[model samples]
Target chain A: MQLFLLILLGIGVLILQSAFPFYLKVAGVKPDLLTAILTLYAFIEGPLPGARLGFIYGLMEDILLGRFLGLNTFCRTLNSYLVGYAGQWLNPENPWAPTLLAFISVWLHYLFLLLPGRLAGFRYPLLPGIVNIIFPTALYTSSLTLILFILLRGGVSWKRGRRKAGE
Target chain B: MFPRRRYSLFLWMLLGGLALFLMGATGWRRDSLGFLEIAFREGLAPVQKVVATVGSRAYGWIEGLKSWRGLQEENRALKRELERLQALNIQLEEHRLENQRLKELLHFAETQGSDFRFVAARVIGRNPTNWYSTLTLDKGERQGIKRGQVVITSKGLVGRVVKVSPNTAEVLLITDRECAVGGLILENRTPGVVEGSPEFKGYLQMIHIPKEAPAEENQRVITSGLGGVFPKGIPIGVIVRIVTEPDGLMKKAIIAPFVDFDRLEEVLVII
Candidate 1:
């Protein structure tokens, strides 16, 4: 039940990301919300939870966007497990760590998405698309991640409090 | 500069990076569509309605202000119109003949035997991306709409349905960067393909017009009928300007589209 709730919650965040008009053109720049959500979950829960969350969230996005199957699935799952492991050393309470980590996560996601498109006989406007996806989303995702991480901490602590009371 | 413990996490991110690399490396990309997606899209209906209600109220208020000033002006105009009607009444028979002559070209669409289910829809959302000049229609599968359906206006052809869901569908507007139309140069008789420019340019470029074609500025451009997407002979736009390559091999012209897409509200979905 918790796992399903986490994945659904992540997808809800992604919808907010897609529905956001961060750019003047509106649809051009979409902040990586699922990436941030996955990152936050991975840091708090560890590797196994992170990977599972990532896989489920990616599948939901695939259904939502009507995208190519297994494409987002692979990228998102891998990032979650890795970020979860890396999250061990960080002070999850520190606002800036989550902020910086989100940039790295989104950047890595962008790079992965770019690689296959270039290799498979697709002509990618390499430098421009990289610049478009990476730099623009970095700052926006950072601020958003910071806020989301704090909210998540509050939720987690509240759950822990309830469990302790039951015991 | 890379943190050592985090270095391992980098490898996982690398796999994700690697997978995206694979997607980009190939020409194939997945585009998803199913009933659940359609339902999810339809789920946006409430949000759109909220925005629309606020917008309609704002528009109504502004229009009310303008109408007050306009009504006085219209009263004066009506006096002159009364005298003009006296003259028009005598020439009514002649005017009716002229109307039939002008409408002869329009008769073809009505006569064509095609199964059509018309759905009236509103423009609910627009692509928040710069590359997209597309709009999302408020009607979808619930209205029996589907991909490849034609969207037109009382004016003329608008575009075709490219993506669909249960209650909503995304329309590839004629003005979008990815949109292209097959058009005939009415004067020169040369057929060409028209696509949008990336300079954040609003106008269209009709490419590969033959040099032998009698091309000139300000000529009318219409659908060539070669592309199966749109019906032939619909008015596209007028040539605002033209240019040629350095070698003068093929010509390209700038076309100003007839419909002002930014202000679009109502459209007819032909299913």
Candidate 2:
């Protein structure tokens, strides 16, 4: 049931990302909500489940974008797993956890996503891609992570309260 | 329960293998739509459309609220603009009719063809990433949209359809790095291939034009009809500047595209 709900949330975030303009985009780069969610989920749930969620969400994103098919899947799954492993030594409840982890995850995600295209002889200006796209996207995703973390945490407490009231 | 480190390694290897397999499969095939992908995208279209509509309405409401105080002034300005446009429209119509009559005479003398058949569609969504410029249109194969069909606005050429589902199609905008168009300079008739410039936003570049070709700044470029992908004579852009490569044999020209991609709302696809 938790997995199902997370999947639904992933879909909703994907739709929102697709349908609307980002509130804080620089150089036409927007925050990646999927990366933020995957990172947060990994921090909360640990490596295996987080990797699974990442794989599913990444696959859906890849299909929806209809560009490179497996690129997101490969990058996101690895990112989630690494975050999950890191989570074991860190506290998820820390306010900075999602922010810092999101920054790292987004950086890794772009590295993985762009490296293959660059290697394929696609001419992405390396310095500009990093400065304009990767760094800005990482900062944007981290900012979004703060908001999403609060919302998810609030949702959990709310659900727990309802369960207590019923009891 | 945490798996053993070796077990985790095995899982990583397994998923890595799967990712490579998918990459290989997708790379081996140039088609974006397989049967399953078509079904998936078709199924997702309604959801995308609904979300887009609701989001747009919400955005409009917010914008309208913010500007409510100036509504009367805005309305008056719009009315004045409409009247001015109406006067210009009358003059343009006369010119159009004269051009059509001249074209008819040319057709009788030279066997010129009719205008292209097109299907109009609304822009539904845009690319989620900044790396590419793609737009999803509400029309698809059901409305005669097909892969490789050229999309255009009233102003000029937009892009080409890259993927089609039952109800939605994805257009690869000409500004994206991957897109290339065969172009002809309106002044000198120099033929070249215009491709999206990676370094510049909202700009295109035509490369490999002969250095001796009299391609000047502000010259108009149009489709050359060399490639069957786009129709002949679609207005592309105007050359902004000529670039001399390190090697002197060929030259590049910077172009400002005719269609404003950022403000695109609707497009007509040449079926």
Winner by TM-score = 2
The prediction achieving the highest lDDT against the true structure is 2
TM-score of chain A of each: 0.79, 0.86
How would you class the docking of model 2?
A: acceptable
Tell me the spans in candidate 2 whose CA falls farther than 4 Å from its real position.
A22-24, A117-128, A150-167, B1-113, B209-217, B241-251
What TM-score results for chain B in every one of the models? Answer: 0.55, 0.58
lDDT of predicted model 2: 0.84
Task: List model 2 lDDT by residue over B10-67, tens digit each.
Answer: 9999999999998888895576668998999999999999999999999999999999
lDDT of 2 by residue, A80-163 (tens): 999999988887788588789999998888876677756544456666578767888889889888888888889999999999
Task: Give the Cα lDDT of each candidate.
Answer: 0.72, 0.84
- Could you give the fnat of all candidates in order? 0.03, 0.41
For model 1, residues A1-167, the per-residue Cα lDDT tens digits are 89868766775665454444333222245566678788877877887888888888877766655536566677788888888878888886786777777788877766776678445333334565566546677666777898987787789889999999999
Which residue pairs come into collision in candidate 2? none
- Which 10 successive residues of model 1 chain A have the least lDDT summed? A18-27
